[model samples]
Target: MQEAIIRGAEFDRLDMDRVPQFLTRLVTRLCVDEARHNAIVKKMASHPRLIPHSADDLVDVVCDNAEAQWLAARLEAFSPKDRKLVLMLTSGFTRKEIAEELGTTPQGTHSALYRIRKKMVERYG
Candidate 1:
């Protein structure tokens, strides 16, 4: 969406010829994001600043909000470190970066993150 791109890119600075490539990059990032955290992706898709433009988009907004809220409530039940791990993961931290932040080995971080992701997907997906 224009707004999504504009939020991260300076409209005047964007090369008109690269619009498709730019969109492709966004789509790829989002696809990866959704794989990591479907609820987080849904939450971002329902940007709070915008009103839905159609009946279908409105339904999507409501569903997204519900899923995001559900995920938030579930996150509260996790250990403090686990919650922070999930937060960092959804915020786009690489596993190595997360391991550094959490003061753990990359392999440990990977396993913990995988466990968390698996649990969430099993229960919520």
Candidate 2:
């Protein structure tokens, strides 16, 4: 569809003629991002966000509550893994569930999540 193509085509373009190398680099990154987006969307639709308790999980709670828009925007700069983890957490997935989906140990996922939260706090707090 035109909408989907437009969504994937976002990039700085006018200056590409002046800097020929930019086009290849930008196109490469766009391709990578599109692939990741497609993977994430498929995974998300099949495996829904798992918010169990509204009280214990800050990320899911924020995502469900008033701060969702702000939280989602702020996560854009995070590495793809970290961003995906945050999205999973907000969807109500426990660390164990995330680990299973990502094919890593729960402990490793926990450690990464701790770091991700620390980075987000530093950036957004």
Candidate 3:
């Protein structure tokens, strides 16, 4: 879920309004491809080592990576408001929508996003 959020944020930063479509396409393709891959792997009786690793193991590797560590450290520096703002933004909410949800103004939401982005770039760049 954390990984998904991170990927979603990256996608949102690239193209905000396209996020829902991107996520739908991505999820559908991944599910279909995973099912096909699993079927092929299950049918194959040879080479057990050729099978793909589990999602947990892949996530573990990602969590342990230097870039992930850096990002995590950066995320830790965010205030509670900033953190929620980023999560909401990454999860596909527009500033106006997030402001309404958080009971704040759109300007506040925009400010939060700007600060979060600045912190992320300062830490990760």
Candidate 4:
């Protein structure tokens, strides 16, 4: 999580043209660690009688809830553009910044964000 925040800050500082390459470099460095951690977790999960109370179990329960499942389905139903707009907006990008990254105007980014927020409220309220 700290690393992701640092990466986001780095991304915010970079020129648009360099962002992709920076992301590629960061992902290359992180992927190996992520894979190793996942493998360890997989092995741990396979063990008999692990921790009685785990965050994974909580996540599983939440995921099984009808409301949570419905929300997940609604999120899944979003178009790629909608998803991208929401993701960028949610990740602390200003309208201008998101517009620059997406090759659109600030007004367009604002419009997209408004629609995305409305859809989220309609789905989750």
Candidate 5:
């Protein structure tokens, strides 16, 4: 409910009469997406990992070494909470999902993201 209104603030205008329906749809969509995300996460957790035997299968190793490690070093320099937030965002958590996980409002989540991006640009760029 609160999340919907926070998200709604992004729109310049909405049909005054349909506002309830609009918020209902927005919440419903978020619920559906969250359910799907949970199911996918569960499925992946139960899936087996395949061992890399060929060069192609090892591309991830090369890529991770080249970029992931570099970004990881910078991410490590953040405060524990900020580092966790960055990891959550990278792992496909929605703003609302992150807010729920962090026990914060969506507006706070958005503000944190903005601050994180600014710090990254200013300190790392």
Candidate 6:
């Protein structure tokens, strides 16, 4: 852990409140990707232990890498409108409020969000 910090792992900077959900998403992705799941399983198998501390460490490293890659892909794939929509959504704006701010109808905002989700699923899944 000290080595990780010296290498700037920055796990301490993460919001503890979001860690569970973040790990849940990472685990879900691992389940979907057979190659990654197999690799993780093989690593765990090779280091079998009653406590499995090494597996836990492996999970932490993998989760951090996966989350960084996922976010990078999301940013790369986002259109300008998609970026704006995400920004608005993150700024505590409701869809209706965002639509108003963007000079669009609420229905339009909903449609945009649906399209964004579809694109992300196609790109990432």
Write down the lDDT of every candidate, Cα atoms only. 0.70, 0.67, 0.66, 0.66, 0.71, 0.65
- Winner by TM-score between candidate 5 and candidate 3: 5
| lDDT, candidate 2, 1-125, per-residue tens | 45654654564454435545755777788899999999987877777464234333665445433333345568778788877776776666766777889999877877886686678789867
TM-score of 2: 0.42
**lDDT per residue (tens digit) for residues 49-108 in model 6:** 733443224554455345434444566557777777766665546666778888998779
Candidate 5 regions with alpha-carbon error over 4 angstroms = 1-73
What TM-score, to 2 decimals, does candidate 3 have?
0.38
Q: Which should have the higher lDDT, number 3 or number 5?
A: 5
Q: Give the clash count for model 2.
A: 4
Better of 4 and 6 by TM-score: 6
Model 1 pairs in collision: none
Worst 10 residues of 5 by lDDT: 51-60
Residue pairs with backbone overlap in model 2: 49-91, 50-91, 50-92, 51-92
Candidate 3 — what's its lDDT? 0.66
Backbone clashes under 3 angstroms, per model: 0, 4, 0, 0, 0, 0
Give the per-residue lDDT of model 4 (tens digit) for 80-111: 87666656654545566778899999778767
lDDT of 3 by residue, 48-125 (tens): 777655433444334324333444455766777766666665555656778899999977876765666677788666
Residue 58, model 3: Cα distance from true site in angstroms: 32
TM-scores of the candidates in the order shown: 0.38, 0.42, 0.38, 0.37, 0.42, 0.41
Global Cα lDDT for candidate 5 = 0.71
Tell me which residue pairs clash in candidate 6: none
Go through the candidates in order and give the C-alpha RMSD of each one to the true structure. Answer: 21.0, 22.3, 24.0, 22.1, 18.9, 26.2
Measured with C-alpha atoms, the lDDT of residue 71 in candidate 6 is 47
Writing each residue's lDDT as its tens digit, candidate 5 over 1-125 gives 67768767766785678888876888899999999999988887777774333332245435423443445468867898987876676565666788899999877977886787678789878
The C-alpha stretches of model 2 lying farther than 4 A from their native spots are: 1-70
Error of 1 at 71 (Å): 5.4
Candidate 1 error regions (>4 Å) = 1-73
